[model samples]
Target chain A: MDSIRLNQLIEENYQKIFLLALKMLKNYEDAEDATQDIFLKVYENIKSFRKEAKFTTWIYRIALNHIYYMNNKRNKEISRFPEAHEMRTEMNANPSSVLHEKELFVSLENVINLLSPRQKEVFVMRYYNQLPFKKIAQILGKSLGTVKSNYFFAMQKIKNDLQNQNLLEFQE
Target chain B: MKCIDKNILLDYLNDVLSSRKKKHIASHLSECGHCRRELEKWKKILDITQEFVDQDVKLNPVPPHAHITQRFSKLPQNDESSFWVRYWVKPAIATASLIFIALMVFFFAPKTVPELTENYYVIDNVTYTETISLEDRYLDNLETLYLQEIYENEELTYDILYGDWQNYEEVLNDLDHDELEELINKMYDNEIT
Candidate 1:
């Protein structure tokens, strides 16, 4: 029964979790290891679930905790994470704008890595997961306003940083 | 409506605002140039943010190796009673059986008779057999006397080492303690004198 549930969970969310770990760890092997470890943890701790939070949210929190632990264990190195502004500017500015389009997608990845842990979480849940603000608030245990504001702050920072670098031009 | 604050603008961009508030923000957008421009920036941020959203964040499938799931299934689940027993029991039993067989092989085997240590020589149609007393202890020095000990026989041929030699364990089983000691002392005396 536990294995069945674990398989179900992995099948459903493995990709998202992999993406999270990849973005967080910024390497393929580490992300794969983290994903495997995360599932093992879920299998072990599923009984303690208690249903206090949404399962998806609980899983995300577990993944986040794993990534955080790994980051700490690795001594908080962000060298693999590209700078937030540089990604945005490079993505938003291009010769044909098509260059910026592909670059933007890749750069967004770097930007997500560059975000502060809190900002990254909120941003990922909002954008990647497409999770509702209320759900995010529940998952984060933060108020709706707090969640919204954090997201706002993240977007604002990215915008300002990109603009300062002259990578993004807001047309008049 | 105080031209919808930045927070409201953000909420509006995220499409989180209620229908009525959406209408109010829309009206404010038409009237207030600053808010409209702020709204445009937020929209661009939204558009830019969409770049990440459209991306499919997928974990690469596990590489082809030994099956991880199969291996994991073989592991004992945590919920069973005596989970440790489930994990360690089979391995422990396997190890004990191996040790037991090894001990029996060590202590109960028949002893080699040093007087029956056949050394052979072939002379025309006749074969001569010279038996050497090789105590197990003298076995160590056999390498030094290997050339002199060579036996040529019709059945054994010119090769004293023709047939495969038994393992030391087999040799150990065949030689009794006293015979082994006598054989060793004789070989030592022969070497010295």
Candidate 2:
């Protein structure tokens, strides 16, 4: 460990970063390796993290950038995540509670891909990483109100899509 | 508690609401079935998301961290020695070099004001002194040589023959007999040489 403080920071944020990258890259091995690379980048450039933004926000910003670069290199769009075909075949075999779970899972995955990039980012940072709106705003360099608004629109879209697919019962 | 705003329910489910708002929503949720259903819907959504994240983490193994540990040992630590090297040692060397340059300039700069020296001169037939230059000494030597040659040819020269020597002769009359005799012997000796 470089220091107890750095180690503590790494431990605190590692899982969230890994999950976030995994979601963005949609490749397990790539995400895992990118996660390590992100941490190393954080360690190398930690001194430049301004006191204005919270440390978590700064870390999130770096993780986002690294994932984006990897995605560009792979020439991947948001929709081109893990093979849905494989999961579909597997879900077809199980038709009980597993199907229910798979429906919700598949609905979320579909809705996620259909989201606008900004909305998707806000959605991921909010739901998957469980970050606060205020932190997301700082990380994205937007106003708190703007972040809250983006999240609002993203959730509305998800809820709307779910209703269209009959995943949830709601007015159009 | 009126039917909750769907956005409020979402915030509530996501735990982004303040604790006070949360309590208010919780009470509303307890009393109201419609709001409760709305909250449940968001709660389900969040639960599914949370599950997805957890499942990913659990299934995908975190890579081996041995390299990070190995790299750290080779990396320089922020110790006292390094701090001194960074903050003080380099500056000290630079400062020492600047002082050395200043001192060299001070010691070796060309002087502007000429030095004063004692000069010798005669006033009222009494000696006074000042610094003498090489040119003044040379001129004095040349003057002495010219005077010597004139002295040797002083006998019957036009200036001497026609010159006013009456006052000099009167002064000579006051001289002692032995001095006058010595002068006459010297004059005859110079004329013959």
Which predicted model would earn the best DockQ?
2
TM-score of every prediction relative to native: 0.54, 0.53
Which candidate number maximizes lDDT?
2
Q: What is the DockQ of each candidate?
A: 0.13, 0.14
Per-residue lDDT over B110-168 for candidate 2, one digit per residue giving the tens place of the 0 to 100 score: 97665344333322324643333435776687568557756777664556666668778
Off by over 4 Å in 2: A46-54, A76-101, A168-172, B1-3, B18-34, B69-74, B79-193
Task: Report the C-alpha displacement of residue B78, candidate 2, in angstroms.
Answer: 2.9
Q: What overall lDDT goes with each candidate model?
A: 0.67, 0.70
B1-193, model 1: which lDDT tens digit per residue? 5767887888887788899989887887888888888888888878877864664342234333234344434545445757677678867988999999999988898876554425322223246444444556556555445544444335554333454454654786789999789878988989534
Report the TM-score for the A-chain of model 1: 0.71
